[model samples]
Target: MNKDIIYKDLDSLLNTLNLIQEEQTVIKRKLSGLLDHVVPNHFIDWAEEIHQQILNREVALQLLRKDIIALKKTIVQKKSIIYFVNNQYVKLIIKYKEQIAYLENEFKLWAKVTAEKFDTIVA
Candidate 1:
């Protein structure tokens, strides 16, 4: 009975992770749409490029909000997975830890790059 509960809990957590990942994908599309709409004004100067980006500040802010929310969700999900794998998934052992670590590192790197771009745009 306890084993069944563990498996069910793990399964539910994984499903939640998948859903959040899908949400992240949609957020990415939204952010991409906003970026695509931004055309560079090469006729002017670098200052003009910044000005154009400023014109889209409202959309940028929205993207930032969505990005932050997704990021927080991802972090929480990762921590939950880590805790579960450490405590419950004994059969997976080494494989699960390595896979989970890889997933975390990849996500963190992606988030860092995204944040850098966002900071540049907002600044």
Candidate 2:
């Protein structure tokens, strides 16, 4: 029963990570397209900054995935399940949630500007 709970929690975390990764991928592509346009220096700088954050987050996600895999192996072997209540794992989930929230707020501004710029070009 405890192992089942741990597996469910791990699955939930993995799903959340995957969703964040997909969103970041979309933002990365949008940033690349924006760079090709005649955007302002500050906008370019901000986009670059966000791009770097996305890259860093990607590394974090990879590491978390590896850890999850290891945890699963331990479960399969009927080893200790202390990893489930690990403070590091909890902290990571909180940190990821905060980062995603920040990115969403920042992306709203980026999207607004990009849409306005695109509209002007079309008109």
Clash statistics: count for each candidate: 0, 0
Find the 10 residues in a row with the least total lDDT in model 2. 114-123
- What is the per-residue lDDT of model 1 for residues 59-110, given as tens digits with 9 covering 90 to 100? 4334433543453344345535455445334444333335445544554565
lDDT of each: 0.47, 0.67
Give the range where candidate 1 is weakest over 10 consecutive residues by summed lDDT. 42-51
Give stretches of model 1 more than 4 Å off: 12-16, 40-89
Clashes of 1: 0
lDDT of 2 at 49: 78
TM-scores for all candidates?
0.41, 0.61
lDDT of 2 by residue, 1-123 (tens): 367876786677677668767877776776687678747887677767777877787887787777666766666676566764577655654665575566556656655665575455435
For candidate 2, what is the lDDT? 0.67
As for model 2, its CA RMSD to the true structure in angstroms is 4.9
